[model samples]
Target: MLTPDRIDSEASALTGAVRELARRTHFPVSFGGFVDGGNAHISAIHGSRTRSLDGLNVRVMRGLGGRVMAEIRPRATPDYGAARHITHDYDRHILGEGISTLLAVPVIVGGRVRGLLYGGAWASANVGEVVMKPAFQVADALATELRVRDEVERRLATLDGATAPASGALGPASPRAQGGAATPTEPHPSLPAAHREELRESYAELRTIAAAITDPDVRARLAHVEQRLAALSGDDDTAQLTSSVSLSPRETDVLACAAIGATNAQIAAQLSLREGTVKAYLSSAMAKLDASTRHAAVTKARRSGLLP
Candidate 1:
């Protein structure tokens, strides 16, 4: 396994991502950290004060971390003590820090909880608005990155003595043409108007495959390709999108929750929406993006700046 330093670095990227997500939100720039048995603990104690801690225990399947590890789902507590079914085991430490609300979303990759990104509100019913929404965004990105990293590690685990057709990426393609200054090339040519439409469909599908990929290198490369195609083919500009692609506030909720790998049932629960209503929102977003699949719809919306 790679050192905790590498893992932490990968996880820390979520900080900037979350911060940006919450910038216009109701959150006032809170901080979060993932603690384990080893190394110094982060996710500093902050409510009225920010205190750094060392040597905090994060046992598997206990407290917020434990439940996330067990359920592999994002958990939210609007009023920690007031909420039912919550074990306030961490209340002494957390309440001392002046936290009133908490949200912990698990970073589950390959069917295991690698770590958690958690935060709380000292005094805000809007914690669900400012904190939880962005928390879900960060969690989704974390899930994507960790899942990709795990897949890369698994594929790399095989050696010359082993025989499996390398289940993931082929690694960096000829870096010179890409890494160096070079002119772009033309896409395949000589197709009818309908054929061009089909190519657009194909490109969208390729982008979905790229984002759906569970390997960081491959996903990154595929995203690059998708971006290039979107730029050249005029598919990426949100300004150029049909009005149908634009999502309303409620529809955005559906798409954002979906981005975090939330199922209809789970999204309905989280959004306090009916299951049928959730599906309706998803279907609407899909129609706006002209996507045949949920993944493609998400990739399109994300690329087009419709969803952060």
Candidate 2:
């Protein structure tokens, strides 16, 4: 279930994306919002001249943004009022802001339309690749973040219902409960095999998400969650093994992808690293774990509580 905090965070993310769109494309007006029910509520705006766009609720199939939402692709018009391809449901707001050219992009995630982003100018102008490219990039980045958050929330919900530490705490307490330290180990026996697999997948996804995030606070929060996941999958007997082993963040990321059976090339693409770089990281991780192969490295890392 979506909580108030989650909704606020989503809005903040959209607002930041809108600000970035305006900055990168130099659009005179940029705004966007998430779709709730059937309307795209315009909750974020930048560079707007007037209050005409405030509180605008764009309905699907009714206007350019709406059509973008319906089509799940970008749409633009050089002359908003004279454009014959789209309906005039939003002319009062669009024209009221003196916008002559408009571009709209859909925020698609998991093959579904999650939100809409828009950029516009007061003078009629062509919307070409130069403008579209950065707009698309911002939208895609936002979509990726949203997808990560969704996965994290879903997995956390499952974990909340699954077994927790005896102290009833689900965070750092789990690690200390094992042996007064933080370690990664084999999956807890009480958790079913399917749940353990799900936890591993979530941990891998979190690592990927952490790699792309630039905000220190967000990264810290994700790291905390990653630690909780690691603690939950630990084995009591191997809790002391982690003191002798330490893996860099990149090494751990590479191993997390490896844990999910991803090939070196796949890990490279996912981590935005060269294949050679991926190999080097893998080799180093294997050496540090004192393993002869990638598979053995992953196993040893898990047994030493270095991985979950």
Candidate 3:
């Protein structure tokens, strides 16, 4: 389940994507929303002429946006009102907005439709690849952001559950203690072998997500989450070294991937950097830590509390 904050964040992401779609396609109107309770509620609207589309709920298989949600593909009509293939369920809202030509694209994540984006114009016009391509790109970017958020939330929930007090235990764990308060110098409780591995994986995934995100605010938030994951490793012995050895963000990201046994090419692909660039970052990190090899660099980073 998503918290109120997460729901608001998702809505903001959708709004940003929809605004970009309108600008990219040069459409007079653009709007979209994520699926909830089997309906795609129009929560974000751009360049609207009136309140006709405001708060509109589009049901699956019921209208143009609905059909796109159901089909999980891009669909459009040069003449929306005259198009007989789709039901007229949203005619009042859509036609009321004077949308004669419209295009709807699905935001698919993990092979499932998570949301829908629509671009429309008041005058009838053919929707070609030039417009469809950018619309699709915007939807794809939105899907990636949504997927990253879902993964981060799931891992955080798991972390919470793992650190909670077990039955018959006298007190909760120190990291996520009962009151959720811990001193800056307090050592994190050791995690199970499996949990530690999960934390490392989550850290690597967060780095990959940060690389692909275009929004600086979202990327910064992900970076904060990465730091939390790193601090949960219970490496208090390295507290002194952590302050002594500083690695740039990109260098740390490369080292994190390397710690997970990723090859240079694989790290390059994950971080969206060239293989040579990956090598340079790795070398720079190794030099900072005085390590001789990639494996040594990763080990030094782990001991320095630079990675989970």
Candidate 4:
């Protein structure tokens, strides 16, 4: 079975995958990633679309790209003004890119518009099935990522957990999602690579101690800490959270610290963890947050109401 960690790692890979596809494909390819709202704001604008001439807050059902998302289908338009019904709304953004003919496809997942993938040309060229083929492939790859993340989440949820509405409807002591109390609740705006590396070391040293420690009092303390870190470490939200959210409690403490901008060495000194162990927790949390960057992960968490 795919572990939560694997699922998140794979979803992240798709971002690069989709981007590379646009760069390699001969068309003036661009991908505007999924925005939080119904209207698809440009998350990533590539090729010609990179040259922005308008503002954000693009409306659906306006231009070639907007229409594609509004209709939840693929569309090819030879002239922007020709689509008089929708042209006026998004003409500026598209025209600035020097687009005379364009194809826009939505990256649909679970009946929702995750993002949009586009291909266009400067002249009125007929972008037939041949031109459209690879575009669909790219969109498909991006859309499929959601399902993989969802599956990992399901598996992670099944491992002796608690279910709180992500909205923070419950109190702080409502208990951890996976049957524990010490886990902290909050989200990151983004999680950096250094944060991830910190958590990585934490999880490793923990395993080392779990197997060999023999003192009764120390063993009991370690056992409790392990369960908490396990719950914290193992959550899967590739589109939403990353390595996995299934972490043990102590691990959650580490994540909370990093979320607050704690350095690995600082976290180590504060929590009495070796700097290495703190790195492990940060890395593991980065995966659970499914955030490629520190800021993004933090945003995802706050938006989900994870960070209270």
- From the highest lDDT down, the ranking of the candidates is 3, 2, 4, 1
Better of 1 and 4 by TM-score: 4
Can you give the lDDT of residue 162 in candidate 1? 27
After superposition on all C-alphas, the RMSD of every candidate to the true structure, in Å, is 13.1, 3.6, 2.8, 17.7
Winner by lDDT between candidate 4 and candidate 1: 4
* Tens digit of per-residue lDDT, candidate 1, span 181-260: 11123222223445334334434444334434554555664454434333333232233332335577567666756764
**Which of candidates 2 and 4 is the stronger one according to lDDT?**
2
For candidate 1, what's the RMSD?
13.1
Question: What digit string (tens of lDDT, one per residue) describes model 2 on residues 1-308?
Answer: 68887787788889899999999999989999988898999999999999999989999898998898888999999999999888998899999999999999999998878999999999999999999999999999899878877866776677666645555544554545543334333335466667777778888888988998885545766886787677666444444364487899999999999998999999999999999999999999999988999998988887776777
Q: Which numbered prediction scores highest in TM-score against the true structure?
A: 3
Per-residue error (Å), model 3, residue 256: 0.7
Q: Would you list the C-alpha lDDT of every candidate in the order shown?
A: 0.53, 0.84, 0.84, 0.56
Off by over 4 Å in 4: 1-18, 53-55, 160-308
Q: What is the TM-score of candidate 1?
A: 0.45
Candidate 3 C-alpha error for residue 7, in Å: 1.6
Quote the positional error of residue 300 for candidate 4 in Å: 41
